[model samples]
Target chain A: MVKNRQWRLISFPSGRPEASNWELVETEAPEVAPGHLLVKALYLDVAPYMRGRISPQPNYAAGVGLGEVMVGGAVGRVLESRSPGFAAGDLVVADFAFGWQEYAVLSPGDVRRIDPALAPLPYWLDLFGLNGLTAYFALFDAGAMKAGDTVLISAAAGSVGQIAGQLAKLAGCRAVAVTSSAEKAAWCREAGYDAVIDYRAAADLPAAVAEACPQGVDLFLDNTAGPIHDAAMQNLALDARVVVVGTASLADTFGAPDTGPRFLRQILVARATVCGFLFSDYAARHEAGRARLRRWYEAGRIHSKFDIAEGIASMPDAFLRLLTSRNLGKQLVRLEGD
Target chain B: MVKNRQWRLISFPSGRPEASNWELVETEAPEVAPGHLLVKALYLDVAPYMRGRISPQPNYAAGVGLGEVMVGGAVGRVLESRSPGFAAGDLVVADFAFGWQEYAVLSPGDVRRIDPALAPLPYWLDLFGLNGLTAYFALFDAGAMKAGDTVLISAAAGSVGQIAGQLAKLAGCRAVAVTSSAEKAAWCREAGYDAVIDYRAAADLPAAVAEACPQGVDLFLDNTAGPIHDAAMQNLALDARVVVVGTASLADTFGAPDTGPRFLRQILVARATVCGFLFSDYAARHEAGRARLRRWYEAGRIHSKFDIAEGIASMPDAFLRLLTSRNLGKQLVRLEGD
Candidate 1:
């Protein structure tokens, strides 16, 4: 009988997600049903949004239930298959709840086939996976980014931000990166952003952002909302668009995320749009993102970065580090040894 | 020699305008300069927007300066013409400064020739003038109202709200009017609103609005911003448009207007737009509104409601009445001799 390890939410988190909230559990693998494939996870992504899933607060999605496997996207290999579409040794990405786990048995329809010749396994979790898909929809679909427009991205060193910067460059836009550290600024510049501003170093962020973007930002991708978002609202040009993706700033202050200044009047005066997007809402466009990313990856036009931690037991720690901005790109935990 | 009387601002008011701030200055008849036409004022339209002009705070336009005629729009008869377009005895609408006067001189281009047969002098200042034009653009142009959409108008008993209600109805929309009292509610309903919610009676406005519009509110014309705007933000439908036109709530409040609860997330989550628009911004469309209103007025498809007070000296009291929610429709003043 095959054995698998999975992380279950032991308790709801009080402030930041703690080790006690997550408990690793072992279970016997289910008998392979027809049209189902068994996946052995290579890399599991730890996104900042997952923090909201562990907290006991009203959020866009329900928090992970106590004693349930922590939900996430994973890049894996098809170890065994009872489905016609997949076979042994095939690589795939799936929106499986088997994250922080060793192996999972999922339906063939749940697994999205990936190209190994184009990119490595972690790229699936970074570029071709949720991060890349989110950046694509938020920037192009939601923000309606155009050529020559100035695009400011918060958390510019993060997985989604890196991809968005490259995409903006490809679209002939002036990409401005707002990062918390100087190292992240360098990372963003290397990724082809026109300008980078260290949000941490500035006393007056709105003035700093305005100085960086003299014409003001036309499009804003807000992942980390705090002082940076408040400044972005003030420095927006006419008909600006702000895409609200994540609230990672909530982690810094425990439960009370800093309430930024009211920007409705500014939005009205500028004729700008501020829109929030849940990734799952665009399921129909997944194929479009997949096709585009595949082309970009095949052409070596985009880069993917992963900050991986080995072992299933370190999943909670890795997620906590992700909340504290310890990881460089996509934060992930690999269960290769277990 | 003809004697001309004009109401000029002697001092700027700290809050609501008072009679002492203005002085009725008598001067010799203004000579028609090159490209300018002489006009004898017939009717001056007193609008709520004038309150914004009297304030010291910076707005979309410059505030009323000391020792200048109070800015307003009026219907007048051309007493003399130096400009090529205007003829003597021609009835026209002028979007110019100092409408609260006996006689004034204006550039020919500033005044739009009106059809007295289609819509009388009062109609041009009411339904076909700035008030009606503002409601049209704010509702249809800026808000992007579509047929069968649900619309909610705050301060529904006011001049702009009443016309907006009829316009929304004419466009085959489900229009809900929110007013101060039961009497105003009845008037709004009689004015052809599909639903009327009395703010004083409804404790839970969002629930009441939801009950009235089972589907959701697709468009919101905001004049009063306080609890009503907050409630409306909570229940906006997918892709809703909230147009912030005026803030009557600010009129009663002392000191700077409170920032209030931030609804930026609500705007984002609903993929909605909250836009602020000024009627003067679309001065080009004034003629179009006049033409449409002319046809409607001739056909009796639309009507104008005016709360007329005799004597231009009563302007201060009329303005106070407008601030206190005592006036039902367009507030105007006529010279006592007329």
Candidate 2:
């Protein structure tokens, strides 16, 4: 009999999640139920949104409970199919709650058919998936981005920010990136960002942003809603648009009182607009967004990097990389690959 | 020569401006320039926005300089005209930077002609002017409030809030008012609000708002950006809209850091939209908006009250009343006869 190994939440976290908060459990691979497919995970995504799911605070989606499989996205190969839609060796991509496992029994509706010939397996979890979709909707729909707009993206070298910067360039907008390390800054510039602010080195973030964007930020892709958000708020142009894409910086402060300068006056003075975005909100248009992103990728107009960590044991550290912004691209834990 | 008695800001206040912060000065009215008109102040307005202008902090407009005439709106009569657009004794309404003065040398372009036969002189400064314009644009343009929307308006007994509440009802929406006193709550009900919460007495303002707005707030007219704003933020419905119309609660906190729960999670969870509003953005639509407001007033479909403080000497206290929300209606300092 084959064994199925999974990581389950053992406790909730008050601050940064630690490796000890999770437990790796081993059990026999469960018998596939009728209309369900038994799949083996190949690539697991480590995304910023997972921080919200593991927190004690309430999130947009239900939080992971103690003893439950942690929720995340993954690309997998169907090993056995009781469902007619899937077959043995067929590859698919899905954001499943049972992501931290070697094998999962999933309903056919839980995943989408994906071909590796179109894109790499990990690409399905990165540029062709939620990250790319976020950047698209954030700039075009939520931000109402126009040509020549000065777009500022936080976490600029990360998967979503990199894609957003490239998309901004394609639309004739100047993109400025905010990152922590010089390595990330170089990557962001290569991704078409006109300027990159190493937030760690920027003594005065607001002034640095203002100097980088002399005309003021017309569109702010707020991937981290804390200090970077505040600095961008202080530099919005008249009628600027702010799309709250993620809260990497506020991961620990979500339930706590986060202190900052009152922004109403600045908002009023700039007549800015703030919109909160979740990729799921555009679920209806996701397939279409993926198609468009795929087209851009083939045209060589867009590119993304995956900061891959090997083995199931690296999953905890892979996810932890998001909190400290240690990953320069889309982070993934690869269990088995070429 | 007529005497021009004006209130000049003598000092910038640390917290709330006291009566002593302003000094009344008497000077002879200057001669009108070739294109200017001499105007006699009839009804001088005291508005919440004036608080922003009086503060030393930079605002949408330049702040009132120390030893400079305080900035506000006024309705007056042309004493003498040196410009072709106006004539002597013509009644006009203008939001002047020198509104506290009894008489002033003016430019014809500085004022708009308003007939007293159309509405009361003060109505030009209230329902037909900045306050009304603010309400119309905030709900219709910025907030994007639709029919059947559940709207929560803060500072509900004040000029902009009262007007916004009545407009919300006229649009077939459910209006909930947030005010400080029982008397103000009654006035809000009289203005067509279905629910009124006395914020001063409510121990848990968020709970009270949630109870009053059982369906959750679809649109929030945030007239004050402080505790009330936070309360509304906690109760937003899916895809709710928040239009910031004032910062009465942030009057003293603009330059200082204001601590509150990090709202990124709350905002993203609800997929909310927040917009900052200013009436000047709708300047081109003023005449059209005034015409609509005048029709509503004539039809008895809308109503507002003026809390008049007598004479130029009372201007300081009249503005001071705004800080404490002591005035139940549109606060104005009357310098002329009824």
Candidate 3:
């Protein structure tokens, strides 16, 4: 029998999660069942979405119960298998139901195989995984982005934002990014964004956005939905499309009452549409999204960056940093590096 | 030549419009010029949308200029004509640019002929006019109503609301109505709404809506923005569509700051869409919408009621009653007897 170390939820977080909210424990790995396999986690992802799962209030996805393993996604290698489709050395990615642990006993249906030859292993966790699929559908399908359209992306240096901005650029659209820091803004500019707005430094975000995309924003991929969303609403062009992908800025007020600028008049006058997008809605078509992302990655049309913590024990800190926008790119923890 | 009496805007309204905001003036009517005709007003429309045009801040449609006639739609008789297509004694409907007046000289392009054989004269001012077109396009195009969908319409006793609720029912959907009073609620039930919620009597609007629509709301036609909008946000079904058609509740706060519930979280979780809909967007497709509405009206699938004010001079009071939700069904002014 092997030992498995897992981070489990001890309590639901109120505002921002603290270290005491989770408890790290070690247990004997369970033996593989008839249709299951043993997985040794190679890389675990810590995303903004995980915050919702740890909350007591019901979120879009199911919340992690107290005393349960923290829910997340990870890339793992099959150590042992009972299913005919899987072998000991096969590399795979866990479904969203998997936990943030060093080892997991999972049914073959709960994971999908990944080819290491297509892209780097980390790319599977960053661009080719949830982040890539999110950017792919949010930009192309929900956003309805077209050539010559001006696209604005908030949280431009973060995981999904980075991919969305690059995709907009690839579609022959003008891409404008909103970032909190000058460093991140520089990175966004280097990533082919036509203009970069340091939201922290701008006196008026809407004015800055207007100056950047003088034609006005036709599509906006919003990750931080607070003041950024209000500004985007004010700057929408006629028939604009706004995709609400994440609310990192409103994490603390998720279950509370929060008020911002009223958008009814603006949206009505502009004849704009605001859509809330989730990748799970397109679960059956993820392969199609992945195929397009793979083509982009192989052609060097897209790039992904990972801000990885060294060990499985670093997940909580990494996640907290992600919430505060301290990390530069996709936040991850390397449980067992190659 | 005839004496023309006109109600002109003297100043922009701050809150609800008052009598002093308009000035009644008498002038000699101009002769019919080339391509122009002299029209004697028959009926005039008073709608919630007219409030936006009277405000100081520009709305989707052009604002009524100070000291100019308040822009609106009116049905009149061609008293004298210079155009070959129009003849004296022919009935016609003026475009939205027409002023509130008893007599005027208009270009033939500024009006359309109305067939008396199709519907009553007042119907041209109510259900067969812009109001009908608004309900038709807003429900079909913006709301995207599907059969069996649970449709919730706010201001269910008003002009557009009354028509929209019946249209939803005719489309094989479950129609629910939200109104300010029990009288209106009873009227909504008589009009074929599957359920009716008296918002003023309900302790909790969202809870009442959920109880009324156990399956949740698939489409929401929101005419009042303040608290009703908040409640609708809280009760959205997955993939819900919210059409922001009017803001009667926010008319007092149009130029001032008004804060209420933030809808981003609810929309994101439910994967819903909130669209600001204006009838002007479908101006090019008005005939298509009218054709559909005409069929429904002729087949008795739709009904319209008008609260008629005695004369053109009663427009301000009629409009104020509409703002306060005191008037039921479509509000209209009789400028001349049949």
Candidate 1 wrongly placed segments (more than 4 Å): A52-63, A95-98, A250-338, B10-23, B54-58, B96-99, B247-258, B261-338
Give the Cα error of residue B156 in candidate 2, in Å. 1.1
Candidate 2 lDDT, A72-176, residue by residue in tens: 666788889999888999998775444666678888877877878755566566555566556666677667888999999987766577778877886789999
Fnat (0 to 1) per candidate: 0.07, 0.11, 0.14
| lDDT, residue B266, candidate 3 | 30
- Which lDDT tens digits does candidate 3 get at residues A213-301? 89877887877677887777666665577766766666666567645634342343233454443323444553453444335334644
Better of 1 and 2 by TM-score: 2
Query: Which candidate wins on DockQ?
Result: 3
Off by over 4 Å in 2: A258-338, B258-338
TM-scores of the models, in the order given: 0.71, 0.75, 0.78
Report how far off residue B287 is in candidate 2 (Å).
Answer: 45
lDDT (Cα, tens digit) per residue for candidate 1, span A1-338: 77676677788767645556676677876677888988877666555656656666544456788888777666678889999889999988874455556678888767778877755556556555555556666676567889998999987777667777877886789999998777667767776789999888888898999998999778888776667777786666655676666555645344452234343322322333323222223445534544443353345432223355654334334434533334433343433232
Give me the TM-scores for chain A across all models, comma-separated: 0.74, 0.77, 0.77
TM-score of 3: 0.78
What is the Cα-based lDDT of residue B195 in candidate 3? 96
Q: lDDT (0-100) at residue B25 of candidate 2? A: 82
